[model samples]
Target: MSEHQPLSVDGQPQQLNQDEATQLAEELKQQIRNGVIPAGDSDSIERMVAGLGDPRGLMRLTFAESLGVVGKAAVPSLCRALSEHDSVTVRRAAAKTLTLIEDPRALPVLLKALLNDPDPVVQGSAVGAMAAVGAEAIDGLLEVLINPNSTAMQLGLASWGLAFVGARAPEALRNAATSDHAEIRCAAIAALGDQIQSLDDSEARGLVEQGLKDSDRDVRAEAATLLGKLHNPAWAAPLLEPMLNDPEGQVRKNAALSLMKLQATASRPALDVRLSQEDQTDVQAVLKLAINQLDQAG
Candidate 1:
């Protein structure tokens, strides 16, 4: 390979030997810093995108950051490479690069990669991009959450996206909280925790109350965990107190831990009662801890 390989020609990736790639990547970074190709200069942009495939980890990161600086002008090419690149390395880099750019135009490509990419890293990068895109990407994330065909990994990523953007999408989170799928409900409830924390939104808090009663034990446990993070004993403590006797031991345990987090001294009596009757050794330990913590707080 040449000592100084040219970037991709006509948007086609050309193989570059490691040394040539390093030199070319540094040159491109300099050009980007000097504002050479930010106007979507086709050749320069394609070269920058191609640099995402650099075999050197540091070079690849440098190229991704530079492409991010190129901003919206780089979205189209990045999207194409993310969806079509034969190299998983290129595809992964492209998705991660879009996360820094955070242009809404890349959401479609990111969503497709999240759902269809064979590589887990590529799929996760797509989720990160959608999250960075913020509110505009909420509906798409919710769509994945509700789709029965969505894999556990995909569902997990989409749920993460929802939590990340929850404050910006309260209405969407509310709708998702009522979803037929337990997984969707669990995700929505968790995201609502974000909404409650960020906005102190009353409606989001109400939905979390519903989550505590969800048919799925996991969802109920998730709801119990969400309440502990709210830091509002007046509201959260009352909600969690009743959960001490929940049929599910995990739910009861989470309720005790949450009460501990709240320092809900008022709930110590309830904790004391549960501790004596608690059959599960783990729940008993958690109840004792909550009571002890509350006693110390008082």
Candidate 2:
């Protein structure tokens, strides 16, 4: 049990034949339970875990077969192996096992799994583990949000997870407006939708202007809603063009409301044609608002 004792990772213990895989597994387990795992043993343990097939092995519903036999002392080595090992299976097993150990450090290390690991399964597990972290983890989570390559689901979830981490994603939101992921774009649009609705006119104007021509039509729709709610008078007319031509009903409706709120009297020519094109419940709302705005302005 020396702090630096090396494991017989080549399966050299007299108790285990090199070809008898079961014996090697048992020996590794016994060593860990006995606190014989030494510092810097990550390389050998990573190799051994890689040799054990998937942590998800043949078992369908649970990690009953592969990870069940590993012991607590193996936890640190497994965590270390996640970053050091070239093998994806090794990284997956380490990220999954951290959930069992409940290590505070595990939460931070798992963030690396989402950002860098070769395996998608491990990356998915890393996202699930975000609830477990200190205040510092908020910055790391925002970093994930800013990464365009992070999966759309990850970006969407990261936006929602911000409440748990409690950090504002100012730059992340702006960058995400141009994101290639539709879900990320949608989530970013909603995020700005709420912000614009609450913000003062000048502050909200910048957001509305930047979001106007977003590639995603849904985002443009939400952006229109924000411009109107914030009463940014300048954005009112430009938002109307999208309402007239945008295929989506919601986007059209959002633009009409913004135009109406801003008393866009000069924008009436653009609005009349778009009103004819819009027929859904969303557009009807826009029509009612437009009529009211016209009456008030006259």
What is candidate 1's lDDT per residue for 43-83, written digit by digit as tens? Answer: 76777788888777999987788788778788888888998
lDDT of 2 by residue, 179-212 (tens): 6765555555555644444443244346556566
lDDT agreement of model 2 with the native: 0.56
Give the range of the ten consecutive residues with the poorest summed lDDT in model 1.
1-10
Off by over 4 Å in 2: 1-75, 134-136, 148-154, 157-298
Per-model clash counts, in order, read 0, 0
Q: What local distance difference test score does each model get?
A: 0.84, 0.56
Worst lDDT run of 10 residues, candidate 2, spans 7-16
Q: Model 2 clash tally?
A: 0
Name model 1 segments beyond 4 Å from true: 1-12, 18-27, 39-41, 146-153, 295-298
